[model samples]
Target: MYFTFRQVQYFVLTAELGTISGAATAARISQSAITESIRQLEEQVGSALFSRHARGIALTYEGHRFLRHAKLIISTVKDAEDAFTAKNDNVAGNLRLGVTNLVAGYFLSDILARFRRVFPEVSVEVVEDHRRYIEHLLISGELQLALMVISNIEEQFALSVDPLMRSRFRVWVSPKNDLADKSRVKSSDLRDQKLILLANEDLLESISGWLQGEELIDQVFLRTTSVEAVRSLVGTNTGVAIMPDLAFRPYTLEGDRLEARPVEGLSVTLDVGLVWRQGSPDTDQAEIFKTVARDYHSKR
Candidate 1:
């Protein structure tokens, strides 16, 4: 009889994840229940929101138009909740942002640009650091919020982590590499090849933990803190690097082409998102910025 907040949330999650099952898993609901919610939502709205495909679902023209309203509703309601529990700082205040090196290079610009366009009056200061250091800043109240890898956070219970995207690491190689032409690459395949490792400790640890199964952590040829350096090495066929989709590119600065293929047996995922102290009150500015980040990630 009415469009409830639960229906709106279900609709938005389905649109974001592009499947009922995905929405279910992400929201900790059942697939049938999600389906029924979408069905009731469509009935109440008097339009088909999604076009079903063999693989997944896609928003219809009307669905795309409605998505804006859904996000606005969700964000507005969440902001209202934040107002009661958190400091009601005006949207015009300065936002202290902590970003990790990997996120700063790969994902921060787009989020910052869109956020600036929407909240131009909000001043933003970003501190780029390692994941642990960023978390430290978040914990110490130096940062209002942070965008970083949340997959393996040491103190997860102390922070509120909202994941924006899942980035799984894979092998990156120059087109000239011997395995470049193969349909798939495996851990054993990379054991003998030269490896260029990113110097980010968390990433280094994730990559090492997986490759340790093959006893191949010692295969590293060069280690650098710069993602571009890893790219250059892989592009020039100097060494193969393993990195997540967030920072992986098919080309280097010199315009040399590269390739990325999934590792046959690796299951590590880098989930990046916003984090703040669990007990700390979020500023209004932080709430709005989080909305901007979510919208950007949803579109991608």
Candidate 2:
């Protein structure tokens, strides 16, 4: 039986979100449309795709069987679209990019500057968010590409990741603060001090693990999701924050209101990189952007 792409998309969205309403919102369609589409699809298959429960829906056995193939079909369609779009030399197309704050602070401007110079007609849009959210966007086709801290990516199975540059973490505080005299503060030294950090779950978990190893888990004071918030909090001398050095340089040097010192044995540095769906089209503009990013970082 022939299955349409829309049917698979509706089916997958419903399955993933576990409710027709949720799926409709995600797919940007009305609930009745998704309901009818799924009904038609189930009729074609002659088996129950989902079992409706009080809370939501669960995939039936037949649904599980079809989902794997459905994902492949969607991926193939996306690859075809990317390939066709990548054919243009002028790069006169929309490029949706997702980036974390650090990438936005350090790498984005240079990349955008170079890309704009090369492809003035190309429209570029950027969404700044944490790593997890960006990855979600990449998988959902909401973002064409993303730049993030690479230490968070555990596997490269379905992604093409290109190493852009390496950066390390450091403990930041107002230079006038008492800790500035030390070359590097130890984990134990931080125990009595109020610690601030970008409220990333993975980063928090990583720090928690390190603190636990050092038996200093109870010392954190402020945890925020915004890096700018961390900076503002730290700038006000509310607490000391640990952040990637790349992001703190400008503020540390120019803001005279704050300072950052190396934290010895903290092991918080990160390798920043770019990621896109594996097997996506590689166009000349994309290649040029990579080259420009590498060259720009190399000089710094």
Candidate 3:
């Protein structure tokens, strides 16, 4: 047999008050609601909990026995809720987090700085890698949190994701590139053009899957693991690349300017945010870091 918390609450209150009307008064609910809950609870247990009287009610032997267990259950639930809700003075703990290479370069510095200022006692350990690897570490419980591009996060983690920012996906082209004169470019416009991709093999594979229908994908000139290489290629008119607007720098290391054109006819965006395992609640130290990240985005 199964019962609900509300049913248990009504059973306990009715037992204490000895009357449905009195229970309703105590619970701030309709008298009929209290009666229904008690009836359902008794149905589950397959026994009448109380014997009716002219004035009120009296607990049967079964009622007395169940009352003890009911109180224990209620108390345990209260303790569990308190554990999650209660404020703790000690926020000192090691915060283990993961970030992708892109997030580490463009997003993590501000959040980490704010977190350190607020929770100096908390030690932070971070790992930076490709998004897929970061998610792997997170799901394996090797990381407490992951600050990465939260859009379309792999379902296997069953994570609790809170979006912090949405950065527009843009294409970086050289001034000499034909698209440089236009304010925007389309996926189809990439045809016959050499492209530079910055990612690990898995990411490249994913991008390739999406672009498989496009024949120009064969012309992907450089498959570099370095972001700098992508920037240098785009700046020197060597090739064009697509990335988030957060990564756009007008000038490269060699002082050559790069052109960023928004991608049209597509809903592509980088949804950056904090992600933690669902049901596995964050510790106080990690909670502080999450708050800092949230506040940093809100301010921006």
Candidate 4:
């Protein structure tokens, strides 16, 4: 037969207090009941847990070994109870969040910091992945929420997407490059400039569509993925790149070496949003996060 939780509790208490009377006192039970429970536990385990000493009980070697596992079980149970209580009544529990590097680099820090300030007990785990993988994980229930590139979202999936901000890509180049002097660059002006593009192929396709609509497709150049690579390449005058305005910030890299300007006759913008699975129960923590994001965007 297996030992009951109460029996394990009694045994652990007896081991800790080193006396049946002390264990009973701490557990608010009678000494006889504590002793009987410990006895039953010993019988179930088929081993002696305590040995009588001069004034109290001492653990046998087996008891010390069993004590560790018992403590783990107790701790796990307590943690579950605490998590349940916090989820139901407090905006404090474990949150599994996913964020793309782009999103985390730009927006997540402020939102998380504000959240920590308000709900100090809430534990947050952030998984940073590319936008595509992060979105897949979020839909699979592996993540509670995610900050992703809505420009890359597929319309076939049923997801609750909330637009947080709208931003456009600006072509970045060395400030000293010839293009820096132009008020606006035409689509055909990029014919000779090497180009770098970030992930989110759909956005790139949208840009292509815009270019095609304006009858300017054959003028395209090289496309690279790494934003850092783009920055380095542009800093060294290797090529120009298109990056989100919020992501590019101040249009300088390591110094006032790089500049970003709008290309003329092109009106391409992407909406970034918060995505979560539909029909999930709204927790206070989720609400807190939502409010923080909305308020943060409203101020910007």
Best by TM-score: 1
Q: Model 3 scores what on Cα lDDT?
A: 0.77
For model 3, what is the error of residue 239's alpha carbon versus the real structure, in angstroms, after optimal superposition? 1.3
Error at 13, model 1, angstroms: 22
lDDT of 4 by residue, 1-300 (tens): 787888888888888778989999999999999988988888988888788878888877667768857865665565455445544345578778887666777778766765665567778898988767777787788888777667767633657888898888678878668788887787677767766655445456546677567554554455655666667778777777766776663323454356788987667776677888777677666666777678667844
Instruction: Report lDDT (CA) for all predictions.
Output: 0.84, 0.73, 0.77, 0.72
lDDT of 2 by residue, 220-282 (tens): 776787777787777767788877766663242224355678777888556788888777777
Q: TM-score for every candidate vs. truth?
A: 0.69, 0.61, 0.64, 0.62
Q: Which 10 successive residues of model 3 have the least lDDT summed?
A: 200-209
lDDT of 1 at 133: 85
Candidate 2: segments with Cα more than 4 A from true spot: 1-89, 136-142, 250-255
- Candidate 3, residue 32: Cα displacement in angstroms equals 72
Candidate with better lDDT, 2 vs 3:
3
lDDT of 1 by residue, 227-298 (tens): 888888898999998899988755677767778988887889877889999999868889988987997788
Best by lDDT: 1
TM-score of 3: 0.64
Scored by lDDT, model 1 comes in at 0.84
